[model samples]
Target chain A: MDNLSMQKLLWGVFWITSLAIGMVVAGRLWHMRLLADVSVRSRVQQSLQLVAKREGWLISDMSIRSVTPDAVIIEHRQHMRGRDPRVCVRIPLGTLEILPCTS
Target chain B: MLLRVLVFGLLQGFAVLLAELHRYLGVHTDEAKYLLNIPYPHPPLMRWILETTDGWQHQEIFWRIVFASLLTQGTWFVWDMGRKLHKDQRVTLCGLWLFSGALLLQAGTLFMPTITAIETLFLCWILQRIEFLKRWSALIPLLWLEMLFVAYQGILFAPLIFVALRQSGIAPWQRWSAFLIPIGLLALYTPTNPLTIVATGSVSGMSMGMPLEESVARVLKLWVIGGSMALSVLGLYGMVKSKQYPLVLTLMLVTAYIFVGFRSFYAILFTPLLIAGLLSAPKLLKSSAFLLALQIAAGTAIFLYVPFPEYSSARSVGDALRVAGVHGDILIAGSFGHEWQYLMPGPVKRYRPDFTNDAAAIVCLDRCVAIDRQAWQRFPQTTEEVWVKIRD
Candidate 1:
């Protein structure tokens, strides 16, 4: 075979391999995005509740105020400190964990 | 023609949207540096461009738009060059798709050297097409702009321009004069040795310490990360089959340049050339549409789902430092010192252990800071602590 034919064959193989890779990547990304959406809110709320409980506050008093792509803002009223004040905690989504609901 | 315009416009819009997403996530270090107008290692043109839109409100968004525009324009130029090189509209669109899909878009999301490198390539392509006599007049300003924007990497482009001139059938004197103009300007304006910048690996922190096997692996890893592994292999085969030796040589040189430096972001510099080579190969013509669609799909998926971590902690640290009444020369000690130096308002000093006493406050990475609760108070409302020195 001539050099040109060989080159053509190599490119043909590369394109097939690229298509396979692209399909796999695209499929994986789709799965991950689905998982993220399904679990992100519950995961964030559970973590916030755990932190509140650890701080000697009731889980019932704390609630998620807002959730953005990068952060989750939680508003909670602390009654144990003898003064009822609403405290807002902003946790980066990247740092948020999926803690068990111990309460 | 309208279809072409619409398609390109949509691609540009998608590119801009991806850039906007990046900006919203957080201010990257380079973006922060440009925002603060800090003297960076690269040329000042990018900073100056960002400075024009500087204001207190939504400045990051403004900078993102500027960056997006640069990438969009660069993509358009690639498409334009593709059209000039190949008759097939599919090939042109595929080239554009390949560019928009690659890590080049991610690099474009920030104010980095990658955008300027792309712009330099665009200008070189334009210069290559211009008539010799006409190019002489155009060459001087183009070279100056390239130098002013890209610094030492701009000099690597000289051989490409030289090849372009040689192919133009211009007389030896004319070609020499055309080339000499830029060299003269570079000598007059640039103080340091351009070659020294490359030798030192300061361009992209690429140096020559790793083993050859490791270096090749690093390059391959970068190629994969950039989402161009298969395209690059195809492009390489295409370049060889087409016998475009100059381009092949230049691409090899650039790959080596990035390989030695080993900066992943620098992989963007050769993307346009790779795409061009791929588009030019006749054998790949049938696959162009499939490749283009797959790339666009992959690009869109990555843009929507991939989480680009923004260096937002720098801003929080800066704000905390100010609120804590820390003033004067602040010391930043960490891997992210360059970012802290840029974000900090006042005269900032990067940490050296000896100069720790000179700072009013020390912004050390959590791991790097010594465990001393008595002498330092950690600032609240920040992921990273800003340790203000206790005043006696």
Candidate 2:
């Protein structure tokens, strides 16, 4: 192969490798949940606490179950006089409003 | 008619992206200062330009559009420069496509001096290529003044200007004398002289420089984000193979500067030469175009999905305060005060640790103030935590 053929081969290899990498990166970013990252868990917790404070709801305990683009799913026990009920609630990400448990 | 539609469609796409970015980001500290018209510690030209959008309903959006327009001009000039170098429209277009996907363009949506600096450098390159300086030698002083007033960083391009002058075959005395007028005029204007201010305070005030290992890491990160790894690798190969010593010199200067003080937007300076490198290999144009398209897609995906919350929380904090029915003067504790001051429609006072005030609300950003939990009602967001006074 001459120089032109050699350059063409290199370009082909680059195109394939870059596309593969690009696809993987996009997939990873798409699936990434802000709550799942251990580093940002504190922030998520603080947000949940802020929501609880704002709504004047006393919580026995809370743990993040999953996070969507717009909301975070969490299992929490709202403080009651004699009963603690663990329920999954969906809280909007930035707005931090805890809605009634879906299921 | 087809071409017109194509151009129109591309512009519409660009405008949408600009709007998305404008809505996504909160005003950064640097951008906030410029937005507030605080032109000190840097040249005033950028602030003056931004002042054009004052009183507009959507001033930030208008600012982004203005910057995007300037960067588009810079990108066009780079495409034209590629054409001059390669004499092949296809190769130049491919280079331009690769540049559009580069991290520089992705981050250029913000209001910053990087775009203006890039525009000045691109204009200089195009003028030098076309021998504009040689044709109109009298404009040399004017060009110098423009460079000086635009940004202090413009002094880096002196070597390129010198090269342009040499290529023009102008008399050495004439070329040397042209710089004198601009220098004397700049010295006369003490307040705006970027050099004097930079010399006295910038080094200590900026807290510039880091360990070599960190500096290298930062540059590598910028290289990957500014241009894709493939583009950079190919560009490096071409730079070595083409033996373009002047381009290499500029790269070294820029690298050294980045080592001293690195901002991600400094990546714009490397773009023209990187495109030049892409143009050097004619055989790879088709494959390179495909790779560039992939880069554009991937870059856009990351930019939209990833949440970088720094300096973007001010507007949200302001909105939350407004919703809480807190009005009149508010005290801001901690940094990014300018961003809050600009975002809020009401009077904003910076909170001092010693100062006592009867403000209804105090928003602490990135840093928390010592406040009695009983005295203030706290509303915390992801980044900014607002404390509204409850006690009289």
Candidate 3:
């Protein structure tokens, strides 16, 4: 094939390959976001419950304020010493396994 | 037409301002270095400009304004270049939109030499295209000024300028003089040590001599994350189809820089050309607006959801040390220790293993914090710890 034709063929291949890769990446990111949306709140709640139980407090309410890959900030109302107050705690996901109840 | 361009510039400037605000609220190691005027590799022209303009005051508002202005100029130049190449206003507008939609704006927001270099490059390209230099002798001084201010990547474009001069029907001796004079003057009088500047080139966190697969994976990850996967793919396809050899060459050189451990910010330099190429692609022209919208949406989603590095922790730690009456000589020990060095209140000294004995405080992360628990007090709010020497 002539140089122009060869160049066109290579570009065609590149276009197809890039499109396929882009689709896969987009799909994976969307899937991850979906999973995070579904599971992150529940996970945060579980962690807060565990913390409350270990501290001998009643878990009145729990909510995840923010979710990051490495850390989650959870706001939970706990009844401690005859007082109920909302407390926000940042939990490092990496150290979750070493939490008092889990350990 | 002039009013429309002005509006576009205003929008681009506003976007840059937003990105700058985001940087201030989040982790920004390199930006801090530039603001603080910490010495590093590359020319000090960018830092000098920031300092002279009082960019360090008011939470770096002045710096942000300057950066936004330069970025607007860059966007305008890119649009003009696109118009020259494609001769279609719609296509040029799409190219500009693609660029304004991407994380390239985030790179432009930083107080870094890369953005300045990019703006200078565009100016050079524009000047060449316009035949602004009637005499070859005139380019020598211009070349010298560019070399002094533009980053190392700017050197790569020297040959292009040379080619332009040759094509302009300049006499052979005059062309050679234009090239040789800058080199001769730079070699004789440039204040910066060439060796030190070259050594500072490896700005990426990646270690040297990494495997080929790892390097390729790093580039791919950077493209996916930094450009938005859809836009990155489209941009690359566009470049290939457009057959813009200079754009391709620029992309390849940038990829090589990344492989050799330059930071991912370098990837953003390709955005203007990539956008131009994308707009030039025949298959993409029909759906250009739809694709541009998708890219903007994806870029926005990633920008909002992603957890960027928080340099605020380091600054807080630095504040804590200052409050505790610790001053002078801080030894930073960790993977990211160097990044936090600019947060030190005073002139930062190079980290030496022996300085651990005499330093006022030590800031360390991860394993360093774990190993030196007895000597270091763990800062409550951050992963890093401050080790204040107990002088009896």
lDDT for B39 (candidate 3): 40
In the range B1-392, model 3's lDDT, one tens digit per residue, is 99887777766666566656655664366665455443444455575565454323354555665565565555555555555444454543444444433344354356454463455445344543645444333443355444544355555545445655566555787567556654543333222232223345445545467777888887766666544666567667887887856656656765666566656555555554455456456455455566556666766776676555445476677667667777666655544532354455433333444555556776655434333445545445555655666656
Candidate 3 residue lDDT tens string, A1-103:
7655654464355345435534644453443342245466466556656754444232323334445666655454421111224466666766653222122
Any residue pairs clashing in model 3, and if so which? B27-B311
Give a tens-digit lDDT track for model 1, residues B253-320. Answer: 77776676665455566665665566557466555666666666665665465445446577677767
In CAPRI terms, model 1 is classed as: incorrect
Better of 1 and 2 by TM-score: 2
> Could you tell me which 10 consecutive residues in candidate 3 chain B have the lowest summed lDDT?
B189-198
Q: Relative to the unseen true structure, what is the C-alpha lDDT of residue B189 in candidate 2, on a scale of 0 to 100?
A: 42
* Pairs that collide, model 1: B206-B261
Model 2 spans > 4 angstroms off = A1-103, B1-5, B84-108, B111-113, B124-143, B168-174, B180-209, B277-309, B322-328, B352-360, B366-392
What are the models' TM-scores? 0.63, 0.64, 0.59
Name the candidate that leads on TM-score.
2
